[model samples]
Target: MAIYRKLEKEDKEKLVGIFQQPSAMYDYREFDEDALIADENCNCIVIENDGEIAGFASFITYRVPTKGLVGRIEDVIVDEKYRGQGLGRGVMEKIIEIAKEKKVSLIDLTSNPKRAAARKLYESLGFEIHDTGVFRLKIK
Candidate 1:
């Protein structure tokens, strides 16, 4: 079983373990905890299994003139050992609860097309494919 809670600096190593999985889509060698928490809108959460990190999820809510309030979910990942156990859904449920409290008009996230399981999970959670052009320029 996994218990979900707000992320903390002490979770750094355990979180690294979870992120080591391929589905995470990023080679995150380290986490900038101070920088993240410095942002008042950051909501990072972790799932723990027997004192070890089993999953991660995060979201940020903000308002704009055109869109009102919206929440963007970020970097949701579960350790390979914890997959198919509903841990991902559990983490997303927590995000939704918080997003509701924040009164967000929408909650959004992006998943790699190769991640079929993840896409199915998101769909089961009531998330639909929103047609939009997601572009990025690697400035570095």
Candidate 2:
């Protein structure tokens, strides 16, 4: 059985493991314990199975310029061994609840076009692809 819950400090290593997976696009290569602890708007949730971390989701709520308030799903991933077990959905549901509680007016996320299953899951969760383009350039 899997359980979705708030990430505790002791669980930092486990949370990092999810981000460290080769397939994970979370960009946690620079993630540190202080980052999670110091950001009040950041919420890290994890899905654990029988004491092992299997999936994770990270969310951030903030007011964007011209966008009042919003909750952004920074990342979501379920370990390959646990993908079909509803763990992804479960973690997303938990994150949604957290967003609601935080009173975010909107929730946003971007997924790779190749991740059809993930896109479907986001759609089922009421997320839609906005008609806006997302771009990025690494400063380093």
RMSD of each: 5.8, 5.8
CA error at residue 1 for candidate 2, angstroms: 2.5
Which runs in model 2 stand beyond 4 Å of their true positions?
133-140
Candidate 1 residue pairs that clash: none
lDDT of 1 at 87: 90
Tell me the TM-score of model 1.
Answer: 0.86
lDDT of 1 by residue, 10-111 (tens): 887777767776656466745788777677688988888777788898888788687778788878888888788889899988888888887787777777
TM-score of each: 0.86, 0.83
For model 1, what is the error of residue 122's alpha carbon versus the real structure, in angstroms, after optimal superposition? 0.9
lDDT of each: 0.77, 0.75
Worst 10 residues of 2 by lDDT: 131-140
Kindly give the stretch of ten consecutive residues in candidate 1 with the minimal lDDT sum.
131-140
Model 1 clash count equals 0
Write model 2 residue lDDT over 1-140, tens digit each, in one string. Answer: 88987777787776667667777746666666677877788887878987888977888878878766777786788887787888998998888777777777778788788878988888787776766732111111
